[model samples]
Target: MGGRGRAYTIVALCLALLAAGVVAGVEWARRWEGSVTLLGNWTGGDEDRFRREVLEPFEREHRIRVVYQGSSAESQVLAADVEAGTPPDVVVMPGPGELAAYAGQGRLEPLDGLFDPDHYDPMWAPEVAGAVHWVPVKADLKSMVWHPGALPEAEVARIARDPGEWCLALESGATSGWPGTDWVEDVLLQQAGWETYQKWATGRLPWTDGAVRKAWTTWGALVGAGDRQRVQRALLANYADPWGGSDPACVKERLEHQASFVRSGAHWMAVRGRYAHAKAVIPGARRDATAWEVAGDLAAMLRDTPGARALIRHLADPGTAQLGFTANRAVPTATYDADPMTGRVDATLRARGTMRCWDASDAMPPAMRDAFHQAALRFLAAPDELPQRLAVLEEMRARHRDAAWLPTVCGNG
Candidate 1:
């Protein structure tokens, strides 16, 4: 070979060796001292709590970094990232249906043995299409009516029956009208039992079905829907604010049909918020309305990187169940006893044989869930339009009959 040709070959081999060495170094760092990116819909104090209670410990223990991205528009952001081929390493979001859809598209990595099954109920972290997909990290309980000040169950019961006697707040930004949906869901679960509620949630039960429509009518009557001035005020009021959007001076005398998370509010504390099972006073409630409507923040892996797997294991650790409520019965009871209200919520979450159905909209396909939220707002504005609203929802459901829905939405069955 000529001298110039030999020199060119040597240069090419040197470049190849340099590239290979660089790739090896990067891979080694990633396998040992890597970072995982996470996305979730927790912002402000919620994000802070998650960081303090979960991320910090995982980082310290695993010596891995967690790059968390918290946003109220978590669904939209995750969808865009997935389409752009830049999805996070892990995603922590409420509503398993969303995760199930990704799992169906083959966008998610099968999380088969990353966490111990003994820490959670099979339903809390169920398999999708024969492969384990997600694990629940936190929980929220519905089927509760909060009242200010201590009152006998009978007194709370009597007040629950009158729409005029309740404090209602319906607005939530971009997801306004969800509070009404919660009311309808708890009412249905209290009236129809888990079997019917589960069917309705998974789109097997038509929205116009007897029980479904009856639940709508029940909520309409309970909340005085279509009282325009009152309805408008509620439609503009924010659900998370203190006083259920009523005057603070009079909040102590009102009742709010909300979830367990709101127990920490100042108004609730000032008046000593107390809860009663919605079944106790809901109109036409079945004698045994044992199913509780609940929400959960479920963790799923989108990238099969080693860092992501380590993060998932840390999340499933029993000690990480320090979130206000845990589905993991193995978590110590003291973890929840920080306050009486929280302790009670945690106890209900851990109660054996107590069924927990997913929050209806939270368990639905994103499109269907968004439509349901709008339907609730419209129903509040025009209670007379329920028949038309039910027809619309049923039509939408029929179109998406084969959508990826969670195999089992309720636990402890």
Candidate 2:
């Protein structure tokens, strides 16, 4: 209880206080490091799988906390957030056109020097000026025809001639009629080829062009003007439900033309499905030609930060890109062993050069894209109104001609 004892006690107290401050500072830094916001259109099982497989691993490795916002109306949500001056650090949108619009408006951060450029196809990460704006995280192969199993050439031909033997769905709630767009786009790609398809998609070619007109008529002959009862069912049915349900009565003998996601879905498993490229089934399809329609979920940084950049880097890694069931072969990530259908799709997507093409509607300006969908529905309801539909689409294209349209949606190599 002398002067020396009091001095020693004061020194120990000072040391303890310093240690506590240090600990608090470290804790605060840790909390700050572990936070990022991501916006995407993956909900339900897709969202859950992503969180478990991709985000959780990234979080564990880097100690970053991801704030994920998954919505069916992701574009609307993102627009609201951007307008409010509070966009997420990163966003994974399906449409490159929408992402391009955001990039043009300076809402996106340049993803320069974050990941290897060679890992992705040029079409997946189109450059703005000299900077890449986004990277594909997931891709779906469109222009595929799904059947219960492999059928003979004769059976295939017979089914192609009968509209009643086809499964068609148009209703998608707010996005109603996009399924029909896929049909016409695939038909165009198969009937005319990528050159003409790309030109029309980007507004370089008018909708009234002979090739475009033929594409529409070809689709009309196939489905749009086909059977009345089947068309009615297609008009009322939800697009996803056809691929997700096991209604034999509705789907029997009916081959479905849908994206590759159908093979990875639970309903496809229940039905024991199989698929062939659309070109193989389309009547009078060019014997020497091959083309594929594709769609992808692209990741772009909106608010650049260390955490956001890290997340982007992870997504850009070819190894990480395969976390989801992507049809992209450029990303050599994990493969689904049990799902052979996805394996076939992955191989088809990986095929080189102009054989692969992005979904034309997805690559078009938003207004034109929506118009395309509505036009599809209209054309289906009244096949005789093809001229009118073509005229209307031409008007929409003219209105948005000056807007940003991708110069290319396919790679030469």
Candidate 3:
């Protein structure tokens, strides 16, 4: 009784322990199957909107859990992760420039057959070394002038003539001067046409050239850049702030030059904002041609795991309509009809996709891009310093020779 009973009891206990271990391992495996990591620059309200409108639905439908990390320094974080061999499964970068560099280095996974490439404008999912590596998940039109309410076309032109009438907000954390860069880039695009804009943006044209020089001068005159008090305030003010300022000057700033997303700002929302084609407002835009500038957040696979592939497919769907503006033509036009402003922007994006160009600095390498931002800040502070600034920018661009620039920044002419 003692030997037989004791042996049977020990076997039963060992079997129980083994069963418990197997069950625990199976549970862990199930949890791991539904989880993926994503890195992006979307933070605060942008992050919330993405989760609410896009991510939450995907998670529910597919039963996958997304671990997202949003930060302003996402590129640096991404680089460190790659170096440490712990990169996120997916990443949504702010532009194609950074993605191009990553794809060229074999750090990114190709996105072939994940989604229909025909759904997007060719530029949004430009080829990377003969294979598509990234696609834009969100897009914003950069060439627009916003007024509190719908202003008559004639009135918009008149308001644009006066620098005092425009609202200038230069503050953007570490990227304070980017507003000016956008202005100059738009001016260049319209005045020089897409041919020259492309050449200049990709570093093929010298920064000291006449077309480039004229763009800076045009922006300075349009914004009254040298006016001391105004410059001081503009430099200090944050661009993200709502326009309903208590200051009489701010209240009187009836016009704002910003991206299409500015429609959601309190000032625009209160007044039922309207937009004018930026060309109409610019002082000396060419008579014959039209173009638009655009920017986007692009998604790329880093790990090629099952979870990452599913996230990529969800992002690439034309039916995913949460983005404020999308370049995907397959997105139902009805997706934006409830908001007239969004409707107009959606149309403009498609009509101009063949002509729309990337924000020049956004297409440049980071070193050149940051230098461009700082140069813009300097130009805003002192219009007379333009010559020196352009020279410095050219020098910096030369230094980044190894930087893999996005092959094409604009749609086919």
Query: What lDDT score goes with residue 117 in model 2?
Result: 67
Question: All candidates' lDDT scores?
Answer: 0.83, 0.80, 0.84
Model 1: per-residue Cα lDDT over 31-95, one tens digit each:
63778999998999988998998898887778798999998888889999998999999999887
Across 105-129, the per-residue lDDT of candidate 2 in tens digits comes to 8889999888766766778787964
TM-score of each: 0.88, 0.87, 0.88
**All-Cα superposition RMSD per candidate:** 9.6, 5.8, 6.5
Counting clashing residue pairs in each candidate, in order, gives: 0, 1, 0
**What does the lDDT come to for candidate 1?**
0.83
Of the two candidates 1 and 2, the one with more favorable lDDT, higher being better, is: 1
lDDT of 3 at 170: 79
lDDT of 3 at 82: 94
Off by over 4 Å in 3: 1-32, 242-249, 352-354
Q: What lDDT is reached at residue 9 by model 1?
A: 99
Ten-residue region with minimum lDDT total, candidate 2 = 325-334
